[model samples]
Structure formats: C-alpha cells, structure tokens
Target: MAARVVSPTGRGFLLLDSHPAGCFRSVTDMVAQIPPKAGSQDRKVALVIGSSAGYGLAATLAGLVRHGIDGVGVAFERPPGRRTGTAGWYRTIATAAVAEEAGSDFTFLNADAFADTTKDEVLDLLEKRFGKLDLLVYSVAAPRRTDPRSGTTYQSVIKPLGAAHTTRTLEFDADGTPALRDVTATPAGEDEAADTVRVMGGEDWSRWVTALADRGLLREGFRTVALSYIGSSLTSAIYRDGTIGAAKVHLERTAEELDERLRPIGGRALTSVNGAAVTQASTAIPGIALYVSVLHAVLGDALQSPVEQSVQLWEQLTGAAPLDLDEQGRLRLDRWELDPAVQAAVAERWRAITPETIAEVADVAWFRAQFRGLYGFDVPGVDYSEPIDPDLDWPAPR
Candidate 1:
C-alpha cells in the first residue's frame, strides 16, 4: 500500500501511510484477542452513523476490535487536512484495513446523515455490499439543519443560563489551578431550542430507522443504539437540563418510537447514557472541561481510556444478552455520572478547589496531555517530523 493523500473540497488534507495494510492488521489483531463474555453472540455486520470522530468513532472501531463486528461507517466530515488527516480518519482507514486483513468487510461513506438521500444511499450501498445489518449505531451531533418538511432552517448555540456566571476553569498550561473565567448564560430562545431539537435530537433518527425498516434492510434480532449523556447537576443546567437537554429528551422519545417500529423485525432501539469523556462535542459545553479534567485526575489509573469505552460499547452491542439498562430501561454506561460515590467526591473536590487552590488538588499534567490528544496533537507513536501528503482519497473499501 503506497502512501496516499485524500483532499476534500472544503476540508483539509489527510495523510495515509504506506502501511495501511499493516495498520489494519494491528487493529484486527487487537479485536480478535478480546475475550468474549460468556454466551456472547457471534459478531455480525454493523453500521455506524456519525462515525467520523469522538464516541461514535471509538464505538465503531471497538465493535471491530472487541466484538469481531465487520461493518461500514457513514461519516459526515472527512479527515481534517488533506495530508495530515484527522484522528478519526486514521482510525477509519486503519479499521477497514484491519477488517479486510482479517477476511472481514469494511466501508466508509462520507455524507450528511441527516438527509434522507444520504440514508437512502447508505441503504442502497449496504444492500449491494453487505446485504443486511445487525447493529446500527447513531452518533451524529450536528448543530444546524434545514427541516425539509417545514422549510425551516434551524441553528443551535451554547450559552449559559440566567445571569452571567463567573466560573473557574483549568488553564491548558497551568492544569490544576482554576482560571477565573466568566461564562454568561445564553439561553436559547424557543426557536433556537426547537431548531436544536431538529438538528441534534430524535427526529432524524426516527426517520432513518423508518426508512431502513421499510426497505427490509435490517436483520432480525437487530439492535439500534444511539448515544446520549446526562451529566451532573453542576453542568446539567447547561447540558441535560438546558436547551440541549430538551433535545436529548426528544431523542429519548424518538428511541421509544424506534423500539416500537423495530419490534416486528425482532429488532430493538436503545439509547446509552454513556460515561463522559473528552471529545470535541463535550469541550464546547460550559464548565465541562474543568469537570472532565477533574474527573480525569481522580480516575487517574481507574479511568477507561477512549479505547476501553469503545470496548465496553462493543460488548453491549454484541454481547449475548441485552445490555444492562438503567431505571428508565435505557443502556447505562455512566461510569462517572451514575456513580453516586464518585459524583459526591468530584462535587466535593470542585467546591474545595478554587483558582487559588487548583494546582494543589488536580493533576494538570494528565489533563493537558489528554486535551491535546483529543485533536491528534500529542499521540505518542506517530511520526510528526515526517513530511505528510495533503491529498488522500478515502473512499469506502471495495
């Protein structure tokens, strides 16, 4: 495999190494080695939407590596930069290459997931390529959309609530010391909230399932899962308790509708309340960086790396029985959010540590490194000194 570069019209270059095959083999071997839980189901084909980065990308790769799931990914964004490529792109290519090396199948579709046309295209491609899909993961998080039915264009914003709140955050350089920062609550108006719902919520999910089911493309006993988060009360006012929360509620409801529709096919729809991790999506929310940084410090050795979380999600999706559900019957991987003991500890720590005392309490070193790693900044093994191609083509693996 010669080195290649893929450059998208609006996006930057993505770098591909001469060893795509080798990268793929590494991923496949990793997955093949994960011990399956007792009575785990045999792995099958899977489809992952919003599979470019963050949790979605992790989940998809994990499915391949941990559960032996061979599948395709439909991503909205291409790799960043033509030569350098985003971390997600590297992961996707690596995943596909490894699956192929393992005598399995993989594909990467670059398109907007919200559009009906995109969904149809995916279905057609799946029908022609893999025939049926056993698991479908929805992990898209778009901020704006034009409602085709209503002809309304919706945009979302992140703002604080009520009076402006001055909060302390971790300075990237200083780590544990709380940097005094003021965050104004910019509540989204009714229209904005509705638009957020339109773009980020359940409506599109329901549509995708409906269309796929109607086409008879889903396998029997299949599972469809979406990711959701309900953070702590500290940040819930901006996340689960605010405009985004409203959208998530709508998403949950959409899950219910999806469950009913999939019933006849012996399929199910579920939403997982995932544990919080550092991702581009999480960073934009007010106060999350501090909370995550703090949590990372506490978890220190105990925390599941993004790779570990991906493994957990794969187990849930491909495990023998259904995933462990919360009181609401939704899948719960709230490692940080649901642990009462941990939450109490973190809240207490948050209150006690201020700008003046942060350095003494938190692990600034770990937090900054992790933050940089989120954007492919500080990966340990990648060769940053080498010249990278700015043009790479990453079409689905044929």
Candidate 2:
C-alpha cells in the first residue's frame, strides 16, 4: 500500500485526524531513549491497562526495552479503516514492534478494558502464556464507562465541586496563534460527580487486581501502580479540587485497600502521580495547557517527559533507584514539576499572563507543537510531503 501525507485537523484541543507515520515515529523515539538493563536478566511479566499512549505507552515501552519484561497491554483503540486510525492504535503497533526487537513476549489486546469479559480474557491469557504477573499498571483515561453488571453508563466531567471556577486558559486560533482567555467551568451536579467517580475512580483498578488474584495470576511480590495527577494551585479549582479530583481520591483510597489485602502475598498497590504532559486527556482539562506551558518555561531542562518519568518509575520499582513516596504513600514522580521554586515562578507568570504577554511568559510554541504531535502532526524527521499509508494492521498478539 502506498502512503499519503496526512494533514493536521482539529478544533480547539480535540484533534480529528491522526497521522499514522508520525505516531510510529513518536513511539520509536521514545523506545530509543530507554537505556537497557546492565547485565540483568530479569524476566518480569506485566499487564498494563490502557497501554497505547501517553504514560501507559511509555511505561510499556520502558518495561520491554529497558528490562526485557514479557507483558500484555490492553487498550481500546480504533483500527485503520475508512479514515486513519487513532494515534494510540499506531503507537500500540510501534510498541509491539519494539517488543519484537527486544525479544520479549508481548501481547496487545484491542478491547474495552472496563468490561468483565476483557478482564476474564486477560486473566486467562496470563494463566496460559506468561504465568503469574509481577506488575499491573492501571492508566485508563476514558471519558465514559459502562458498568458491566449494573448495565448503567457513567460519564466523567471536569468541573469544580462547589461553585463555578473561572480561570485563565490558553486557546489557539486557526493560524496557530496563542491567546489567553477566561474559561468558566461550572460546578458538577451531584449525579455528575458520582458518575465521574464511577467512570474515572479506582473501582475498576480494584476489580482488575481482585480478579487476577482470584485467578492466581499475581505473583508473590506483585505490585500495581495506577497513574494519577494532583496539579499546582493554579489548576486546583478545575483539576485537583474538581470532579476528577474526587475520583482520584477514590483511586488513592482503593490503592490503600488493595495494598493491605495483598500484604499477605508480599504484594503492593500504590498510585503514582505523574508529571504533566500534552496528552489527549490533559488538553481537555481547563487550565492544564496553560499550566503545562508555564511549567515548561520554568522547569525547562528539569521537566520530565512521559518517557523519562516512566523510565525513572521502572527504576524505582525494580530497586535500581530509591523509591520516593509522598507522605500519603503514593509515588512522587511529579516532584520536579511541584518544586517550590518552580511553583513560585509559575504563580508569578499566571498572575502576569495575558494574550499579548503569554508568548513571552510561557512556552506557547512548545505547547502547540506538543499538542500537535499527540495526533502525529508536527513530528520531527517525518516527511510530511510524502504519502503515508494509514491502513496499518497490528501484529497478532503473542
């Protein structure tokens, strides 16, 4: 099949079409950056839910290339058909390719991870192929989920719990010029808050872990990490103190519960607060784009990319580096972004930010490029003028 050039198409932060070649290149670049294990012959088995893009994808790639871990990844992604596939679809294929190169047994399941059937399928696969799993990474970020038993659907909302939250946000025009505008996110209703908790909270993580343990698919030292975020005060109203924050609180609590339950088996469950990045999920949040831009401006070289954070996280998990946990017993990978000096600088910039001065106050260009790159656009070394074949197929799951 011949390849065709795919242009970027989207309104606001929601991208419409994704470039397959660019997605492949992006995953390849991430895989290349992970340093291999030094004379260590570790053969860990893992299952990473939502392991197609963002932090999930980075962690999957790091495990395969850095430690040669055999694993299975579950992600809900659209395959290439009438239009191009999702960026995550391409990234999954690219990750499987990396696994092949590293000689690790890896499987990618394209199915709804929130479903009971998917859980059963993954548990069966683990029992048959890779045996007991040493790690489970929960990084799902779907907008909605259907309760497998109750038959009720829950949709998540990004709104404050109390009164309305008005904040300065970043927006881009059609010509790619940046603008700072005030965005008011009204409070979520009681039903919306509960539904958001249902969809985004730790219930599913607990379910997965419980099912795996029941099926005897978890090893004695099994550890599960769920990705989470608690942003700076600038985004607290819409993020850390919002509907999503409520769900996160539930997730953290679930981790504690699971940690206690798994103690007899020498297992542990904990949440890892990851650094901010330009992901499809993050861009939709009210002030995340502006906050991330200012974060880049202030932290510069100190800022950890998703891949860097994943690499460090793996090191901590495998005992190569010291585990840094916050007082709440959650991994603190966002330490750099949450630094006192960095937050002070970000606060100053947030106060002085305006449409005219945003470019100078924040890394607007970098943010724009990062956003575009999420949909496989504006990627370095990609031949935009050349044609790309969007109809790509994922390798058969191992």
Candidate 3:
C-alpha cells in the first residue's frame, strides 16, 4: 500500500475521511509522553465510555500508562472498508498496542454507547473478566442520540437560549487563508433546548452508573468523572450560556445526585471541568474556534493539551495533586484556562481581531493545524508522500 493522502471532504472543520498511519502515530506520540508506571500486584480496572478520541482517549491513555490500570473503552467508530477507518478507530488500535507494550489488559468495544444493549454488553464483560470497576469516565460527545426505551431521536443544537448572538469566527477563504467572518446563532426554541439536554446532558451518565450499581460492578472507592467545560464570558452567549450550557448544568446537577447515591460503598461521582482543545465537537460551535485560537495565542506554552489535563485529573484522583473544587463541588481542571489574566489577554486580542488582521491577532494557523491533526493530517513526523496502507485492522477485544 502506497502512502495515501486524505483531505477533508467538506469545508469548515468537517472531516469525512481519516488516515490510518497518522492516527496511529499521533496516539502513540501522546502515549509516549506519559511515563509508564510499574504494574501493580493487584491491578484495578476502569471503563471509559466514548473513549476513542479527545479527552476520553486522553483519560484512557492516562489510566493505562500513568496509573497502570487495565481498561475497557467503548466507542462507535467506522471500520476500514471502502475508505479509511475513522480516526478514533485507528487511535483505539494505537491505544491497544500501547497497552500490550505496557503489559496492561485492555479492551476496545466498537458499539453505540447510548443503547441499553451496549450497557448490557459492558456489564457482562465487567462481571466476567474484571468483576468490578475502579473508575468510570463518561466523555461522550455526539450530535444526536436515540432514546433506548422510547426510540425517539434527540438532536442537539449550539444556539443560545434567548436572543440571537453574533460573533466573529474563522473561515477559510477560497485561497485557503484563514479569514474572519461573522457567525450568528439564533435563539434555541424550547424543543431545541429540551432535545439538546436529552442528547448531551447527564441522563446517559446517570444510566451508566445505575446499571453498574445494579449489577454490583462498582468496586469500593470507585470514582466516575464526566468531562465538562465552562468557558469564559467571551463565548458565554453562544457556549457557556447557550443550550449546551443548559445540558452541562443538568450534568453537573446529576453529578451531585450520583455523588450522594454512591455514598453507601464509598464510591463517588463528579464532573471534571476540562480545559479546551481542538476536539471534533468543538469545531462545530459558532465562536469556540475563534476563542480557542485567541486563547492559544495569549497563553502560548501555558495552554494544556487534553492529555496534560487528563494527567492532572489522574493525579488529583490519586491524591498526588490537590483537587481544586469550585463552589459547585465540581473538580476544576480548567482553572488555568479560566484564570483572570488569561481571559483578559484573550479578550484584548479578540477585540482587535478583524477580517484583515485575524491572522496576526489569533493563532489561526495553529488552530487549523490542530483541527487537521484530529483526522490524522498535518502531523509533525508523518510523511504524506510515503506509501502506506489505508486498509488495516486491529485485534478484536477479548
């Protein structure tokens, strides 16, 4: 197989194809950054739902390398057939390869996590192999979900709740240069808000926890974290104060309820407010790409990757670092991203940026590169001209 170059199919952050080798290399590079720990005499087990990409993948890698824990990851990914596999599929393969190298037992299930049948499959696997779970990470990010019982499909939107919001965002011009553009998201209707909550909210997280408990799959001192983000006021109207925010509020409230419910076995549930990164989901938000690009310019080296944040989260979970909880009792892993100085700097840049000056004011190139990297393009060491096979397969889960 000759090296195949895969370009995104659509404009504005829509990637329809992925590169197999590049995705593997990117995941391996991330895994290499985490120093592997010696396997414990009695290794623990963790389950990461939606563990194919973004923060979920970071958390799974952290558990395997930094904490020496066996892990089970559940994700929906496209297998290689007429085209290359989804980026998450290759990344999962890389994760499993890393696990084998580190001598940690790992399993990857390619299935829809929101379905009850998937839940049953996971429960059976846990009971048969691991017996109990030490950690459960909920990191699903999808555009829509079908209710397992009702069979009703709920689709989420990114609009604000009340009035329309207009913000400056980035879009590529015909010449392929990052150009500034005004993007607007009208207010979400009541149904839209409700659907967003139903799709992206905490109901799925709650369901997973309930299923685990009912099956006696939760170990003593078990911990569960659902990844979250609370951006600054710059993106509040379209993000933090938008329909997605409403869903996040429900998620946080659900965390509180689950925390209380888990008190019997010393188990705990909390939401980890993670820092921003170039995720597949973030690419679709109206103003988030612009905001994050400016943030990268202002913060520079201080900006944390998803893996870095996950490492800190693991440290906090294991008592190696302090758990900085906000008044809402949610773990604050996004503290640095939300620091006053950082926001002020980002705001100043945001105000000065324009269609003509966006390239200079924000790190648009960095943003573009990172976005491309998500689908295994524009990576550092991967040679695009080299021949490689797109049709590849990884070992199936045991």
Candidate 4:
C-alpha cells in the first residue's frame, strides 16, 4: 500500500495514515519536555489503564516526565496496517522507544482492561518488576465491555434522560461538504442505564484497585484516577443527564469508596472530570463537535490538551498544587470548560451556528485541524504521500 491517504468521511470516519510518524513526534516531544518539580524526588513506578492514547497516554507520559516514574500501560488496539495501525498504536510504539532509549522501565500491555486474565498478568508483572505501583490512572472508554466474572457483555448507549432529544449534529456530506443534520436520541430503555453503568462506570476501576490490594500491588501513598465529563446545558440531555451521566455518577461514588479503602495505606483515589477536547472517545460521541470547536475558539489559549490536564492532575497528586475539590468532593478540572463567561460565549455561538453560517459562528476550521491531528495528520515535518513497507508493524515492547 503506497501510504494510503485517509480523511474524515461523511460521518467523521476515515482509514488512512495522517502522518503516523508525526503522531510519534508530537507525543514524544510532549513527554520528553516534562520537567521535574523544584526539589521534588522522582517516584518509582506508575500504571495507566487504557494507556494507548488520549488521556491515558498523556498521563503515562506526564508520570514519566514530571516525576521520573517508569510505567506499565494497559490497552487493547488493533495491530499496525492500512486499516488497523492507528494513532494510538503509533503513539504506543513511540512511547516504548522513548522509554527504551532513556533506560526507563516502560511496558505496554495490549489486552482487555476489564478481563481478569489481564489483571492477573499485570499483578505478576508488577510483583516481578516494580514490586508495587505508586500511581494507577484509568482512562478507558469503550462502546462495549464483557464482564470478566459473569461473562456478560454490555453495550453502552448514549441517549436522553426523560424525553427524546433532537439536536443538530455536524457532519460532512458524501461529497465532503460540511453540513448540519438533526440527530435525535431516544429515551433509554429500562435496562440501558444499568447497562451503561456496567460497561462504562467504575466497576472495572474498583475491580482493578481491589484486585491489586488483594495481591498487595498497591504501594504506600498510591494514587489512582479515572476520567469523567460534565458538559454544559447544551450537552446535558444527551450526556450529563443521560445514560452516560448515570455511569459517571456511579464512577464518582466509586472514587469515594476507593479513597476510603486506600486510606489505611496512605493512598487516594480520585475521579478527575476533564475538560472537553478532541479525542478518539469524544469524537465518537454524538452532537459535540460544534461545542468543542466553539469552546476552543472562545477559550483560545485557555484550551488545554490531554497532556496539559494530565500534568495538572499529576501535579496535585505530587503536592505541586493545593488540592481543589468541589462540593461533591470531586476534582473539577473542567473548570475552564464550564466557565460561566466561556459558557455564555459558547452558547451565543451555538445559537448562531448553521450550515450556511457555521464557519462564522463556530471554529470548525480549527476543529478539523485538531481532528486531523488525532490521526496524526496536520503535523509538521512529515511527508504524507511517502510510501512504506506495507508489512511494517509496531516496535516490540520490552
């Protein structure tokens, strides 16, 4: 395959390398530049669930850069190819190389995070190598999960809370023309809330922590984290108040429980509600592109990428910042995403957006660029049209 070029299709889908090597460059550059705090000693080891890309990957990099922590990362991804070799895969490959060159202990485990088999392997690896883990970051997001204990599979649904929701979804025409269409989400069925919770909620996280505890894998002063989101009113019905919202609520509660459980060990658990950003996970969610772009436009330099948030989250964990908790006892890292002034401006933009006037109202141009960056496109210093050995695969994990 001569460097098969891919672009976002009508429904925001694509299967092409947007400069795979550029993906490596961006993540590698970000991770390498992370500096340790003043007079702060580096930690020993870390673990990141869902670590292949996005927040997990950023957290993994941040852990290594800022705290000089070696890490074990867990994620499931398809292998490298014209079809399967993706940004996350390339990012992981880049990470392994950096770790190796730096003589740092980094292991990338390609496996299902929800499976007991994976947990067992991680336990064994931790005991053999690091002996214990100081940090555990869970950033897994999926449409489906199979229960490791009961062997039940659950598919998560995005829907409205009470009534059906009709919203404008931004998409491109079959001919690649940007357009807007109405996307209506029906109310959830009786089992959907529970099912979404089962698949996307904190059950897996709780299981991981508890399993680690049972195996004595959690070190003293251990820390663990999971990601969550609470968008503004525009996205509330389909997100913050819907099936996924129920799951997040449960996840927050699970954080409290984990905190209590880790108290004796002088460890802590936290659910960091992150800001909205262009990620594989968020892009797959319906009816949010316009908001994200507009948020970027209005927030400007205030918009923080996963790397920025990851560093901030790790800072508090390492006592680099005063811990700020909301009334619910949760970390509100989405402070900028939900800023009253920013929200007002975004709402104005949202009300003014249309197929014809979208370019004027929202920053789709910037959003599109960020979308390309997700797949390793829109990156400098790479030739996209260059061919490669089609049989190329990720570097072996050490």
Q: What lDDT does the true structure give each of the candidates?
A: 0.68, 0.91, 0.88, 0.80
- Candidate 2 regions exceeding 4 Å error are none
RMSD (Å) of each candidate, 1 decimal: 4.9, 1.1, 1.6, 2.2
Q: What digit string (tens of lDDT, one per residue) describes model 4 on residues 91-110?
A: 88877776776567888888
Candidate 2 lDDT, tens digit per residue, 1-398? 46767788778997877898889899988877888777866789989998997899999998888888897999999887767888999988888889998999999999999999999999989999977999999999999999999999999999999999899889999999999999898999999999999999999999999999888888988999999999898899998899999999999999999999999999889999998898999999988999999999988868888989999888888777888999999999998888898899999988888888999999999999999999888999998888888888877977
Number of clashing residue pairs in every model? 25, 5, 4, 0
| lDDT tens digits, residue span 1-398, model 1 | 23343222221111232222333343444455455434444758888897766778777667665566767788765454423455555556666665675555777887777777788888898889777889988998777877666777788766543434445555543222335354667666777777778888988878877787788888988889888988787787777777788888888988888898889878889998788777767766777777876776667767655556667776777664458887777887776555888788778888877667675566656665555554444445555455445344675666
The candidate with the higher lDDT, 2 or 4, is: 2
Q: Looking at model 3, which ten-residue stretch has the lowest summed lDDT?
A: 1-10
Q: State the lDDT at 129 in candidate 4.
A: 88
**Candidate 4 runs further than 4 Å off:** 1-11, 14-19, 32-40, 81-84, 174-176
lDDT of 3 by residue, 1-398 (tens): 34466655656788778877778889988887786664443576889999899999999898888887786899999988777788998998888887887688888899999999999998998888889998889999999999999999999999998999999878876445998888888999999999999999999999999999999999999989999999989999998899999999999999999999999999889999998898999989988899999999998878998888888888777656787899989999898999998899998999999888898989989998899889998888887766567777755875
Worst 10 residues of 1 by lDDT: 6-15
The model with the greatest TM-score is 2
lDDT of 4 at 69: 69
TM-scores of the models, in the order given: 0.85, 0.98, 0.96, 0.93
Extract clashing residue pairs from model 2: 3-387, 3-388, 3-389, 4-387, 4-388
Ranking by TM-score: 2, 3, 4, 1
Residue 287 of model 2 has an lDDT of: 89
Candidate 2 lDDT score relative to the true structure: 0.91
